[model samples]
Target: MARNPAPFAPFEWMIAWRYLRARRAEGGVSVMTWISLIGITLAVFALIATLSVRSGFRSEFVSTILGANAHVTVYDVGRVGQQGQLDRAIADYEGWAQRVAEVPGVTRVAPLIKGQVLISLRDSSSGAEVYGIARDDLKSLPGIAQSDQAAGDLTRLDEGIAIGSGIARAIGAGVGDTVKLTSPNGVKTAFGTSPRVNAYEVVYVFSAGRYDIDRTRVYMPFAEAQAFFNREGVADELEVMVEEPEAVNALTIDILRAAGDRAQVWTWRDSAGGFLRALEVEDNVMFIILSILVLIAAMNIVSGLIMLVKNKGRDIGILRTIGLSEGSIMRVFFICGAFTGLIGTAMGVVLGCLFAIYIDPLFSFVNYVMGGGVWDPSIRGIYRLPAELNLSDVLSAVGLSLGLSFFVTLFPARRAARMNPVEALRYE
Candidate 1:
């Protein structure tokens, strides 16, 4: 009778499984198994969690930037004044804005007036960014219009200024409460230039969910702003919203031609490109660092396997004498490491995925344990700590962990396979 030889035979699995069991009295590699298993599991979990949070943070950052800001801003680069400000305004902004609106990808085109002001209430005072925009145009903004959140009544813009929630809180002014706005760019009297101080009712309170924007932004009626800033019949810039913001570059030519070449354009990317690049760089650096962690955990297998081979030396010699081939012996140890890697990776994936999928609950639990202050919107510029479990990121982590485990395990696995039966038996 002819019998066929198979790779990784049933006996090899049986032997490998047997060795994996911890026999504490016999002093096997039980501790090492636990160490390697825990190490790989924790390493993979950390990598996945970090990558997911990074992804979520990046997503929230980009969305906030795009939501609360102009996708493309058109500035009048015509003439610089003595004070280093754009003295010349967009004179024909309406005509050009309408032309730009007709562009295929162009969405909203609002002519705006922007200036820095100081806002003060009864006892509180803070710096503010005053924006002059029409009521219809302000309502048309996606961040405001599409929000399910209550950002006060847009109807209030007719009679009073719309202030951000942070500004309202800082100045201790609520809806219908009066707030004084003092601007450096004020009316010129006999005295060189007196600061313009004006009072307006805070009609609306809106939150952009951003610390910087909410803390400093105030919106006024376009007509009122013209009278206040003393720039009647002219606009500071044309704020444009686009359908596909990421491809904002594609519409540059049409916008330039429509707004005229004299008009300078600034995209969202132009203003925040450095920040986004920094985030990307940080993501890469963190991945590299965590990958090294995974490798170190994978390397823990080598020590355990070496000790395992030493403990099983006499058994190895006896098995070899009983006709087990070298390949069979190697496969047994390989199975040991491979099984550890597989089980650890599987458990890690489960935990990591659960963490990402339930980040809100997880953050809530952590925040509760830490007694709050887990997420600081003022510093982080976002309301929540986010996590996004990406398929690709998980796969990359898995590949790295398993590949390192298999590669590192080869060292001691090969050592066990090459043991001479006579030497092993003599030593025993």
Candidate 2:
């Protein structure tokens, strides 16, 4: 007698064709198979697309933080409550700047004195955050390159200031306009203390795309800040630039130790803890909730295979009688179920990537349909929302969904394989 070929056979097409033929003979593809395919397809699409969107959102948040804040912030945390020595602060800044530059990944360092102050021009008055900066110190800040330049070297100006685009528009001020500023003295003026105030001309307006900053940031000279605020020598914060934003936490610790209590050190995350935590929580919750779509689709695979098992009971019984082993029978069902999942996931991955790639245009379309949309990058004062797609994110989503689909069908496939040959044959 001729030896039977391996139970699964050598040709994949043969096995697939057998399945197709069987499917057609049994009144064509069953409703269960159609449902299962669509379910898996939709699940895969939703999971992939949702993950891509979440990834986009997370990146947008990171970009916003980086644009609005420095990578590392250094400030006095001494018992003195604050430090106020321009010469001392500059000396310390130069020393720390050199040392920080020596550290691996250190890119650049910038000095700033940040404080809240009352700003008034003519009859219009508003509260704003005043950032006293040296032109050299803030030149590398994102979007600074786009600022309008004045006649003299920026750092050389003793009392010049830069306003955010929003602030300029709001106050109806422009270059050459003079404004008065007042800041609290850290003590009541009536207690033999006087708040500091000064007059300065608007030099340039910088738009950093952070709406809040664009609407409220005021940049002036370091000396001017001291004269206006009565704190001449000390800096409220030092902004350190880094090669990689992710290394900020480690660098903050190292910088703190180096500064030795002259100031508290902070990372972007520390400065924006509440927002970061909220974003993280939202990402996790969204990921978990969306995963249900894939899970539901996996369940459909199980149901479809169960229906196949019931319909093909006679075929399975005949094959077993002809010497096919239980393991081989199981492989057939597993292949069928896995194939369905594979096809759905592949399609979903393609569509998901397409969606991410064209997200901006799609949003624009929605905006156009709605009759109007936000265009100013400085609304709240800065640029528009940013988005990016990371390959790792896509790979992770597809890998997870495919793995889940396979695992979910394993037991069902085994159940069909383990059916007793005698019992299956006895049916009908």
lDDT of 2: 0.70
Q: Please state the error at residue 309 of candidate 1 in Å.
A: 1.2
- lDDT tens per residue, model 1, 56-126: 99888888788778999998777887988757588898998998999999989999999899999988899
> How much lDDT does each candidate structure score?
0.87, 0.70
- Candidate 2's C-alpha runs over 4 A off are 1-13, 17-25, 78-105, 120-125, 146-159, 172-201, 370-387, 420-428
How does residue 197 of candidate 2 score in lDDT?
Answer: 73
Write down the worst ten-residue block by lDDT for model 2: 145-154
Would you estimate the TM-scores of all the predictions?
0.92, 0.80
* Tens-place lDDT digits, model 2, residues 1-428: 97655656654335544663465556435566667777777776676667677666666667656765788877655442245533324336666666666677778777777779887899887788988777776666665534443222344345488877677777777777898877776444556766767788877766665667767888877777766665665566677878889767767767776665565777887767796688779877877887877888878888877777777777778878887777777777777778778877887777777777887787788778888556565342224433456787677767877898789778877887788778888845
